[model samples]
Target: MSRRLRRLPAIVLPLLLATTLVACGDDDGSDSGSGSTDALHGITITGDVGKEPEVEWDGELKVDKTATEVVTEGDGEKVAEGDQVSAHIWIGNGTTQEKAYSTYDQKQPESVQASNDLSPVFKDAIIDRTIGSRIAVTATAADAFGEAGNAQMGIGNKDTVLLIVDLMDKQVVLDGPEGKEQPAPSWAPGLITEGDKVTGLDFSKAPEPDRKLQSATLIQGEGDVVKKGQTITVNYLGQVYGGKKPFDESYSSAPASFAIGVGQVVSGWDKTLVGAKVGSRMIIALPPAWGYGKDGNPDAGIKGTDTLYFVVDILAAS
Candidate 1:
């Protein structure tokens, strides 16, 4: 199992939104409506869409197999194969009728590659559904976690799982030609690049920390400007001001993908990278107020008063 599958609690096992690819098995030929007779029969979900839903089950609820039902129809674009989907999910343990996980608590919905490694029940319920649709579905242990049930969530091999999903948005991932590189701004951190690879950074003339966010485009791109709420792929290098070496960079590994403007990352990244065009490289400077606040990220060796610097290459956005 991938780290995404292994680390997440079983309730939100399907909520792994990381960019890494995982191999999935073919469907076992179970009908989407196999358990429709009992679907949504004893269950009730009430609340505004896109927010935490109130779930209640009248009595003992059980499903012998997999099933799906639409709780509310949507009027947006219908989902299709290969679309990167974003959704708010709520899961409950059918046997115990206890709430398991809700993305609403995180304040940000998750985005995943539709039809990729997802349970057949989830794919069937979500595919062809329009954005804004609210759906309820049931999955038998075999349909969900299989023989190795999750012991942490008290789900046994025979336990059934219930899910409520709100289709928030979807986008078709598109590939575009790289944009032409432009000259770096005079005030930006000095950078040495060799055909899109940053080889060296110079901060000798960098400004002193002032607890404010600052940004300068080193290489302007011609592609569409990235917008808030869109998922983007980027390669970046980061370091604390006055550090001997960069703290992190995506060049040595896979490019990072995350939804912008949703606080998925630090506020500095959301503010500086949202409007940058694909193929562009920008340098961002973040003060304590926007970098990590008073409690800096200890694991990264960032301190409460440390200023952070980043040079980011915007690769793709959707």
Candidate 2:
């Protein structure tokens, strides 16, 4: 699943850097409810609601305890505690003035739940926030990850960590495409049987490849037409033209969600899926020029002259 077709630049950093923990005894130094705005004193953030941001601070910033601040007030729906918050996140080592993690690099947001199991620093940052809100959380390395700190991320035990979160909309993911069924073209790829809806594609009867981009809708949805710059959720399967084996598919796993028509995906997907309505099911073909170009995604076992064929089910968009 970790392939170039899903993400050209593969950088998926977790909200918290993971490390094994060994409990020696009961510790009373928990960061929950130990929130304050003292850490935001000299920190400055600049960016729009749905874009990556810039964080700057004077001197060496330090956080003895976890702190939280609302940089921008959003007028969207309130997210109840324990509910999932789908957000684009960025984290930097304030002590080192170095960037550590960001979802913005992949143009994708991940759904994070703010429960007691989550780090107390993160719970304070995400709980009870409204969609479209911009928030900042600062903490000592111990409160953020653990006392050991994340050595791989260049964070030390005494370093301060700054995290910025843009609360994106509640992600809408579907098992499969659901909409009005329509007749498919004769030359289009056929579906493989399962219990009901499926993403397994069959290209046995498909014709030879061509030098053009083409698409055909198999199901017409009643939802809003997808627009450029919208982050879309979809279950898709892709194959090299005339090949029986698929290069990629999301049939049994979680749906992929990313910004569309903004170069987050290949040109073929941006062009064909932007104008499509949510819940629509379509099959598309992308010649090398519209697909991987001359490189042809060598990592995906595709050649320089191959065309990529895909069957996509548009689940939702925001």
Candidate 3:
């Protein structure tokens, strides 16, 4: 049975850029020409880890079932369940031997959790693998997308899919604060205690919106200062001015990771969080102009006129 795709919480992080699967013919299970003993013999890939691979295959490349080969074994930490893994993947069509999607084109690794939501073959091949590993896997239609296949990707019930993945980094999910505790700023609008399980926000008296962004450090960190354009992982809580409760919080969910100053998040976060040291706690108040302007996120119970308030904990940055 095909498993349901679990949607992750809203964050600025980029997961998979493209997942296109298409239907193709079956292979005879015979060697085409290459001397390799693997089921996929005609195909040959040449490239270093972290770079776009050059694929050479002529005739129809097909696999009757799922198979995986470790191109390069890494020396880094082994990946486990619930760990956030960053990888660059190149997917090719088995029928035409043409490239479908590649993260190399974007010049950034897409991060994903090692969960069942991913293809069974893919999750099985990468989990427990060490970082910096290069993996090549072939999956049948049922093992890849599903028996029904995806119409959007032109995938059919019997087609096979090929994937070449470069495992870049892996991070275990953090359960709580990892930095030294500091007192919340007296002038800050919200209060966050180090020992408190839940940090409450008092929006009854809203701070007046200002032309410039207001930011204060609540905890001091010993890590390196964050640089622009680098991806960072964080835990956060957000609320609108004059609201009784927080509209969103990563404290209750997994920490989010995203590149900074890239317009993926609100302008206020892009401006205030950059240059801050990793492991630091910060409070940033965003005016409507910096936040979701005029048409605020109604799903979050934020109005167009509401000012956004945030208490963020910087965890790690790469």
Candidate 4:
């Protein structure tokens, strides 16, 4: 699902200007006496093979290269044309070792994966690379995400990045019954049961395929079933059906609150919960159409066309 986002922070322009100034003033093998903008394009990169990459092949886990490292290594397995892989990765500056973005920082080392070849930053390089292999990919600031990239990532104009990745597993897409079936998982408060799973009680309709629609159900409060513009709070956990593997959860620290039917939630939730009364617990089983869709999370090892389940607890509506 796509939703237009808020504008970039006002300070982004200032960061871009500062990076330009720093690039112009550097005299250490950078910049020409001439005033051409081409100097900004001269970024050099180098790296060490942190340690030999550990590798094993079970036929399922195959890479082009059996032996791989950072500076010099083997080209791991060839990622099948459409296969998606999951990985654990750490990124930093290849020259100075300054840590940039890291999966460790999010405390979500396994859930971060990439599947797209275009626009997605992590795609292309790691796609087609075998499991448990390591590669150092270098991209220009222009090649990254650009100005928003610099402000959001804190990378400088001439900065070079080194991404150290560990391939974990590859995900396979399932069609029809081939998909795993999940029984209901353990439930917390305000949950109701239809089958083995618990669901939110506020919605009036079940899920619909290939269309967008809104339905509402009531819980405890008195108001129009979550009106179009009202702000609301909800708690939800996203899990793979049949496997009980949770991909995302908002129940760890506090229940999540957002505007009803807004882009704050995925299109599936927005369409399903518009009329749901607050305090009603509902369950949603979403095929890939309502979930991550065809481009599954390869980095987290999710395949395209996978089914997903969610348990939602409505905490507040405003």
Candidate 5:
């Protein structure tokens, strides 16, 4: 991974949100009805569509079977089985009365799969629901994490995990920059590309090196402008100027996600990426002062005096 970007949690969905959490494999799963049949109806969810909801309840909520409730109906895109949905999830321990996780805190929504692989409690809650919907799920540890339970989260064998999910919109991921090509900057290094893919940065004919940071946009995209403290996704390639090859790139592994303009990434990326729009492709040139500093990323073979350059494709921002 490029040191210019910050690495999100090793697990993007927290507890691998794609894995099965319930053992209900035979049926299509059960969707709880309104009012009495709603297992997680005790908790209150309130908020505008496409945003994280506020959850509240008077007492501990426990359910014998995996219970799901459609907290609110959505008016956005319709989803189907196995399709990926952009959702904000909040997990809490009903037995311990403590909150476990919330996407609001992370400042981004997770891409959850509405497929059979998901737990019965979650799949049943989300299936047939359109974007902008809100679903609440309640299940015991036996039904959620199985018998052993998640020790790190402090959930005992009998504890239950409560989740409130807001299906905001469909996830938008890009394989490359989806923007119009612009004239390359004369001051920056030449971009070597094989078709739509960026291969490396060639600084052979570039201007004399300087310590100050600089940036240039190669492709202009008309998408939402990125802001400070928002989590953004991008495909990037980084190299030490004058080096033969790139030190790291997202083409091989895929797009990476992290908080931007919040010191989570190097200062060069934080200052350059913000105010840019999604789908734009930009290049940045920064000296050691704005890169890894005196302790230039030795693991990537970067030296203290290495002048770093990066080619980035802004994919998504939230």
Candidate 6:
């Protein structure tokens, strides 16, 4: 669950006013309603949206809705009362041109329910929103983001917020073990012969010490050639090269399935797993650039410059 901090209404009002003045240029002709069509003047993209954005606050603010324009987009399946939904959202300052927040942080698209905590506006805005429908909303600092408005996001008090929300799909979560973690796979007791081959790597090697993110070999599994976009599963363990021990690991035999080449995995996994084959045992050395950046896992005693090692197995591919 995401951490939500609600600001006091008193503290919020002054910040909201400051952000509005700085971002919206006097607010001389702005509307008062949170759903005003003419709230935003324009929108722009500052960087490549295809990559994992370093910051989400670079998209320009653009609002072009007529007075009669309704927020509904006739695209997604009708959102039932308790349906599950996921989205790629972008929030921007209409006047300052700064981005405020987004869900692009998710390696995969984020999943949310129709609960109040997911998004206050989504419950009402998405009732009629169809799949693939694009919706844009312009709301005042208070109306859109409640008391924790754009001021906290670095905007002035009166700054209108432009929210370009994409309602991707509505899904029903299976109530059983589909969402549960799979059990670990057992290691083959016998020696891994030619049957153990690399799954996706055209080449494999030991990672150099202090390397950012390099591929490592798994001790078991057949190294069959794997292709991009294929889903694969494997069990693995991660450790700091010279530190205590494996602080993270997958189920022993149950490898996780993920779409390769896509941003589904971390930057290192996507960069190194290009042509690896299945049934292969490999090790990887990950540098801070390829691993977690400055914010190392304090609990694991991994520092910014520390390298990581992983013994991975390519058990199965889809």
Clashing residue pair totals per candidate (backbone < 3 A): 0, 0, 0, 26, 0, 57
Measured against the true structure, the TM-scores of the candidates, in listed sequence, are 0.61, 0.72, 0.75, 0.36, 0.70, 0.41
TM-score computed on alpha carbons, candidate 1: 0.61
Quote the positional error of residue 147 for candidate 2 in Å: 12
Candidate 5: lDDT over CA atoms?
A: 0.74
lDDT of each residue in 125-178, candidate 2, tens digit only = 566778888888777777776777767677887898888889987655555667
lDDT of 4 by residue, 1-318 (tens): 011110122232222222321221112232221242332123222333233223221222111111112323334565564454444455554334456555434332232224343222344345555555545444444334443335345665455444456555554321111112233322211234444233332222323232222222322333236666444555566655444345566455434434455444455676676776555555565665655568755544456765555666554454
lDDT of 3 by residue, 1-318 (tens): 000011232221253332322223233332221123484545777788889888887567677776677777788989887777888878776766767667676566666667544554566556787898887777665556556653444456666667788899875434444566666554457564456334667744544655356887777776778887767778788877666787787676567676677666777888899999887778888777787778776677777787777888887777
Model 6 C-alpha lDDT versus the unseen true structure: 0.47
The runs of at least 3 residues in candidate 3 whose Cα sits more than 4 Å from the true structure, single-residue gaps closed, are 1-41, 58-65, 81-84, 93-98, 113-119, 140-160, 170-175, 178-187, 192-199
Backbone clashes, candidate 5 = 0
State each model's CA lDDT, in order.
0.68, 0.72, 0.66, 0.41, 0.74, 0.47
Clashing residue pairs, candidate 1?
A: none
Candidate 4's C-alpha runs over 4 A off are: 1-77, 94-97, 105-116, 119-121, 173-318
Order the candidate numbers by TM-score, best to worst: 3, 2, 5, 1, 6, 4
Poorest 10 consecutive residues by lDDT, candidate 2: 18-27
Q: Pick by TM-score: which candidate is best?
A: 3
The candidate that wins on lDDT is 5
Off by over 4 Å in 1: 1-26, 33-58, 63-81, 95-109, 119-133, 140-160, 172-180, 186-212, 219-235, 240-263, 274-280, 293-296, 301-306, 313-318
Per-prediction RMSD in angstroms? 6.2, 5.5, 6.3, 18.3, 5.0, 12.8
The 10 consecutive residues of candidate 3 with the worst lDDT sum are 1-10
Q: 1-318 in candidate 5: lDDT tens per residue?
A: 344344233244433443333443433344464553667646776787556666686487767767777778788877788565667788888876787767777777765557666667677667778788887877877676667766656677788778787887765656677788899877788989888788888889988777789988899987899999766778889988888999889876656666678666778889999999888999999798888888787778988898889999988776
